[model samples]
Target chain A: MKLLELSGIGKRFGGLNALTDVSLHIGRGEIYGLIGPNGAGKTTLFNVITGLYQPDSGEFNFNGKRYRAAKPHVLAGAGIARTFQNIRLFANLTALENVMIGRHVRTRSGVMGSIMNSRAMRLEEKACRDKAGELLNLVGLKKPHQTLAKNLSYGEQRRLEIARALAMEPLLLALDEPAAGMNATETENLKELIEGIRNAGITVLLIEHDVKLIMGLCDRVAVLDYGRKIAEGVPDEVRNDPQVISAYLGVDGE
Target chain B: MPNAHEAGIFKRQRRRILLAAILLVLPFAVDGILGRGWLRIVDFAMLYIMLALGLNIVVGYAGLLDLGYIAFFAVGAYCYALSASPHLALAFPQLFPDGVHLSFLIVLPAAALLAGGMGVLLGAPTLKLRGDYLAIVTLGFGEIIRIFMNNLNAPVNLTNGPQGISRIDPISIAGLSLNATQRIFGITLPSVHLYFYLFLCFAGLVVFVSQRLEKSRIGRAWMAIREDEIAASAMGINTRNLKLLAFAMGAASGGISGTLFAGFQGFVSPESFSLMESVMVLCMVVLGGMGHIYGVILGGLLLALLPELLRHSVLPMQQALFGKTIIDPESLRMLLFGIALILVMLYRPAGLWPSRVRRRELSSDERPDETA
Candidate 1:
């Protein structure tokens, strides 16, 4: 069954059409890939899906529920979590604290409840900390107590972002260019991590410039060029579609 | 390992007891050595600590710059003054033949709630602004409140205008009037000493709440917002509500402090809630190390007492050295205070005592070279 379905989604920025008539259905437990050339509105589509931008026109349905997702936090609360392209980790917070913050959407404690420091809040907080630690280990990050998010290595920062995203226990995780600045080995590790995320029963929506990683990991891929989907199919079919080839290469066969 | 952990807990408990003992004797000690005037300064220090801790929740934890924080203080002061004093009775004598002198118990929480409501009013319009822009708007808000207090006399005399509100009732818990000196067990308890204990208890409660907030989910979410607002929202933190909550919380503290101030000083004036007072409170939060509780307390105590300490020392020192009063003591105090602030910021950009995570962030800049 489709975990997230979008139909006729359109976003406009003044005179520029960022995304037009974009529609895709992401099934549960599938690593869905969204690939495009520069200025293809890949990130814009991600933003619209994540509720950062209000869609000029669209029908958004997630997990059998229909809603506009009015705000990013609302989308997050509804089990849709996302990470930024440039890795927006809380720089001054520790690795554990970063992930613990991600657990905020799942946890329900307000100012008074926290200030009261009730037995239940303490237990919830401890459980959150333990869960955050487990997620860090899953992402291969150690010494979370000692290291700030800003002090982590580039590759480790990417993994930490993934851990932070996972801390929400999201049904669907949207990642924007998770492998943006990685070497070959790092990309390989990221590919495996994405697959691991899919195997964990969470749907994955990924936008990456690493074409090989996308082709290797995604269950199905959709290709967009100039804010329009040129092709949508399994990896091999999308890789060979004539329209997609023309969009990526040019009709003149350059 | 367990034994070491137990030892750590034991040490912490012992330190807590030692600190408590010091607090218990602090007023009497000051009274015996320096005089009752110093105890008043100490009382004011406790109030500043509450103000600093409140502002820290907004500016330090949530990274929202609020320069109009004094407005909330003013709101609280006026709330207490109008409610417990004869101002209401004189203005609307039909409604209150005798002044509406409500119990202190009712006024304190009422004032805090009023301040919190005003905080929401301030926060709603300024949600889109941030950084220096937020500061500018908040600065305007502070001035606006003071100007209103100054001019409201013509329209309603609600705040008594520039003349201010006087003869406000002192705090009395369970009919035990703190305003009057009482003799118990042949130990004379001065009004200043009574106020010190009351203020200390309230300060301790503020510290406890602040510390509790700094570690919980709300505090983490606030820090997340401070770090990156968009990321925080994406992480499922409702940035709008959280930001407003921080403001309200901070304003509530300011309100409580203001209520106490109005009672302590026996008057409420527009001049007391000036832009300068807001900046002074912000300085305490910044200089004390923004996010650290103890650092803020240290900052509050030092700033509150520094001016008076300078008053006592600068003129006397000049007399001892040159045998004459040459440089003005007040001006010299301000000059020294300014210089000290600049030097501390220059040396410790993060803070005088920064949070551990912040220290790592400041020092991590040099690491890229090593990694490369």
Candidate 2:
């Protein structure tokens, strides 16, 4: 079954075309990789999918239901969540508290119930804590649950962001440049983390510049050039595609 | 593990009891040693603590800058004055031939609801605004409310204009009026002491409510929004509703404190709710430590007492130094106070009682960039 279907997605900023006629589809639980050269609109596509920007002329479907525009929280409610290209963790909040916030939409304790803290509220709170702890452990962060997000190592912050997103229980998770600043060892760990996320039955859509990681992990690869999808196929076919090579290395080999 | 847990609980219980005992005996101890004037300062400090906690919900937890929070306090005071006092008896004599006097319980909630309603009203249109723009709008809202209080008397005689409303009924429990002295077991308790105890109880309640909020799911949502609004929304937390909730909750506390102020002072006026007063309350929240409850309370106490303490000591020092008052101590006090506050901020930017997370963030803020 198709988890997400986008057709003719177009977005513009004044005179600049950020994304144009971007059409794509991904089946449930597939690891889809999006690769592009600089200014190829990779992050813009993620923003559009996550409802940060409204597509000027396109409709997308989630679980076969069409939507033209929805608020970020509404998209999240419909099982769509994404990590930012820049890390956006709640810097002052404890790591556990950060993930617990992602658990907010799933829980239903209103202001009065929270203030009163009845049996039901306490139970829900305890359940949220346990679930968040499990997610933290899944992300391989252990024994420093109380540490602030800003205090976490660069690699741990990336993993913690994923954990926070997973706390939302998203059906399709979009990770934007998950291995931006990681060394080879850290990138190896991220590969396992993304595969683990897929093994858990969640669809993974990722944007990455690291060709090795993308070619190694993606079940299917899609390449974009100047806001247009130049090629799409299995990892090997797209990696050897002439159009993708010229787009990455430039037509005149500059 | 069980023994340690049980011992922790026991230690906490013992500390709570000791604190409660001190609080219970505080008014009498002050009355016996320091006299009534000083006790009144303590009472006002508690009231400001409630206001600071209320403002903390907006400025601290939710990260919305509100410059006009004192407007909610005015709304609350007016709500009580209109409902339970004869200030509007002549204007709406048909509704209350003898004036609609109500019990303390009735007007307290009424005032809170009224202020909370006003909060929503103000918050709805300005939901998209943030940072300095939000501050400007709220500051305007506060001034607008004050202007209405000053001018509403001419057209409707509702707020009695700048002359203000007087003769407000005192808060009472069951049948005992807090305004009147009571003889309990042949020991005459002064009315001021009664007011102090009542204010203390309400302050305790506010503290409890604030602490619960800081640990609850809703509190977590607010903090998330405070940290990163876009990421928070992406996590399925509704930013709009949470911001409104912060405003309403904060205003609700202001309303409660305002009602208490009306009852204790037995009067209400525009002068009592001014821009300076709003800034003073906000200062308590910021200087005490923006996101920490204990920090806010400590800030409130210190700021409230500092002026009174200055009043008592500044004149004596001046008299001894200059043989007479060379400059108005009030003016000099502001200069010294400003310098002291600047020094404190320079020394401890995270505040004297910062939340652990806030302290960590502030400390790390000075370090060189580590994240690539």
Candidate 3:
């Protein structure tokens, strides 16, 4: 079953067409990878899907609900959670607090409840703390839970961000350059983590510049170039497509 | 032996107890040391602490810069003034034939709600504006509210124009006016002392609410918005609703405190709620530590007392030294105070006690010493 589907998507920034006629779909529980070169509109596509940018024209469906232009929070509530190309963890917050904030959509406590600090509110808060703790452990942040997010190392911050997103418990998780600053060991850990997240029944949509990682990890691959889908198939088939190659290495005559 | 972590927690717990105990008796201690005039200063200081705690929700937790916070204070004050004073009787006449004077209990919550509603009104239009533009709009809002209060006398005489509303009824509970001194359990207490204790209780309540919010999911959501609104929204926290919530909650505190201020002074005036007062409150939040409750209270106290301290000590010293006075005491006070604040701020660039994240971000030199 398709968990997320985008069709006829178009986005523009002034005179430049950042993305045009971009369309794709991810089956439930599949690790789908998006690969493209610089200025390929890969991140822009992610932005359009995540409701950061209003598409010039397009429609997307998530869990059978159609959205022409969903607000960011609405998309999140509709089970689509994403991480940025650059990490955006609440730096001042504790690693645990960052994950707890991710549980915001799940938690039901309101202003009056929080101010009153009733027994039910206390229990809910404890549950949130416990869940946040588990998510941090899942992401392999073995540091103290009270460690501020800013104090985490580069790779740890990346993993913490993923933990925060996972805490949202989205049906489909979109990660943009999750291993951007990671080294060999950290990337290996991330691969295992994504697999773990998938095993937990969440479909994954990934954008990575590291072709080798994408090739080894993705169940399927889609290539984007010049704001359009150049090629998409099983990882091996998409990797062998001539258009995908030409997109990566430009056509010589042109 | 427990680890270093356990030791740190133990120490913090002990320190918290000690701090609470000191805060309990602080007013009486100040009264004994400096007399009624200084006690009045302490009372006003508590009110500013309430305002700072409220402003902290917007500026510190949600990371919204609001320069028109005093507008909420004015809204609250005017709300109480319009409903609970003879001025309201004069303005409406038909509504209250013999002059309406309501209990403080009724006025306080009414004013808070009015302020909260105004907060949402201000928040809705400026939702898209960020940073400096947001600050400018809020500043304009503050000025506009003040001007409205100043000129609403002719057509509808709402705020009594420049002369201000006087003889505002003091807060009374169960027919016992807090303004009157009564012998309680064989000890005679001054009316000011009674008001001191009452204001102390209000400040304590504000502290408790703030501390609770700081630990809960709502507080975390606010901090997340402060850190990154886009990321916060992406994480399923509604940025617009949460921003409005911050403004409303912050304004509620200002309103409640303003109601108390009116009851305390027996008056309400536009001069009390000014742009300069807004900046002063903002300074307290920044200097103490934006999100840290204790830091803000400390900031409120020190900044609130600085001018008074100068009036009593610095002015006398300067007069004695120069025979008459070489410089205007007010001008010299501003110069010394500004220089001192800058020096102190330079030493602790983030704040005296900034939230852990803010402190870490501001002081890169201290980063290498810590581990992840």
Candidate 4:
């Protein structure tokens, strides 16, 4: 069954038609890849899906329920979590604290409980901290949990962002250009991490410029150009299609 | 063997307990060894510490720059003064028909509520503006409150219109009045010592609550908003409500301190709540360390007490060196202060007592190397 389905999604920023008539289906536990050149509206599509921007026209269905996510927080609460193209971890907060913040949606203690330092509140805090530490460990960042996010190496910061999002325990994870700044070794490591997340029964929707990574990792690939989907199929068929080849390598085979 | 996490938590708790013990005993030692005058300085330092911690919630945690913080202090003072003073009978005879009314117990919480309500009022409109625009709007709001207090002399004469409110009553506990002539436990103590102890208690409470909040979910939300509002909102945190809560809570603390100030001084005026008061409080937060509660306490003590200490000693020391006071001590002191602040910003931008989080951020690979 389709876990996330976008039908006729359209978006406009003033006069700019950032995305138009985009439709895609993401199956449960499938790794869906979105690929396009610069300004292909890949990020725009992610923004609309993650509820950072409301699509001008579209119906989004999640878990067989027809609904529109109007705000990012609403989407997060609805079990949809995402990482940005540029790492946006809270710089002053420790890695554990950053992940703990992601656990806020799941936390039951309120302001009064915290102020009074109730026993239940202490237990909740301990659990959250423990869960955050586990996530850091899963991401191979256990030793650096107390280090500030900004203090980590570039690759570690990226992993920390993923750890923070995973703390939300989302059903579907959307990653925007996760491999954008990575070296070859880091890219290989990220491929394994993405596969591990998929194996853990979470669906993945990823936008990437690395066609090689996308083709290698995605169960299905959707190609976009000038705010429209130009091709959509299995990786083998999509890679061999004449239109896909021409669009990627250019019409004159430059 | 104990893991890193357990060891870290154990160490932190032990350090906190030790710190609390030192704070509690240090004041009494200073009073015993340094005398009453120095104790007065400590009292003032404690008061500023409370104000800085309050302001830290708004600016440091929530990332909202409030220039009208002193207005909440003014609101608190007025709330306490109106309820406890003989002037209440003159203004609102119907409310207090018997005479000047309200026990200290009632006035304290009332002052906090009144200031918190004002905070909501201020936050509601300015919430739409961000950055410099918000700062300007709050500055204007502050001036409006000050001007209203300055001009409202005729007809009702609520705030006394620059003549100020005086002869306010001291705090009374259960039937025991803490008046100037009152003796506590058979020992006759000066009013300054009484006030010093009161402020010390207030400061301790502020530190305790702020420390707790810093470790809680709300504190994390505030820090998230500070780090990235857009991302925080996306993380299922109600950014707007949380921001307002920070403002209200910060204002409430300011109100409590203002009540203590009014009771301690037995007088208050419009001039006391000015733009300079707001800037001084901001300096305390910035110089101490934004997110760190203890850093703010340090900032508060240094900024509030250093000037008074200099005023007393600098003149004599300069005379000894130059065979005459080189300058009118007040002007020279301010000049030195300005230069010192510039140097501090250049050399130690993270402040004297940066929070662990902020210290890491400032010292991380992303930042330039500096002693701060």
Per-model TM-score versus the true fold: 0.97, 0.96, 0.94, 0.90
Q: Please list the Cα RMSD from the true structure of every candidate, rounded to 1 decimal place.
A: 1.7, 2.0, 2.6, 3.7
Query: Which digits, one per residue and each the tens of the lDDT, describe model 3 over residues B329-364?
Result: 578767886886797688876668776666656764
TM-score of chain A of 2: 0.97
What DockQ results for candidate 3? 0.63
- Candidate 4, residues A171-246: lDDT per residue as tens digits? 8999989998899988998999999999999999999999899999999999988899989988898898777777
Ordering by lDDT: 1, 2, 3, 4
Tens digit of per-residue lDDT, candidate 1, span A170-226: 999999999988888888888888888888899999998889889988989998888
Worst 10 residues of 2 chain B by lDDT: B363-372
lDDT of 4: 0.85
lDDT per residue as tens, model 3, A66-135: 9877898999998888999998988877899889999999889987898899888999989989998989
Query: Can you list each candidate's DockQ?
Result: 0.74, 0.70, 0.63, 0.45
The chain B TM-scores of all candidates, as shown, are 0.96, 0.95, 0.92, 0.90
TM-score of 4: 0.90
**Which one wins on DockQ?**
1
Which regions of candidate 2 are displaced past 4 Å? A252-254, B94-97, B185-187, B320-323, B360-372
DockQ of 1: 0.74
lDDT of 1: 0.90
Native contacts, share recovered per candidate? 0.86, 0.85, 0.84, 0.70
Choose 1 or 4, whichever is better by lDDT: 1
Candidate 3 chain A worst ten-residue window by lDDT = A245-254
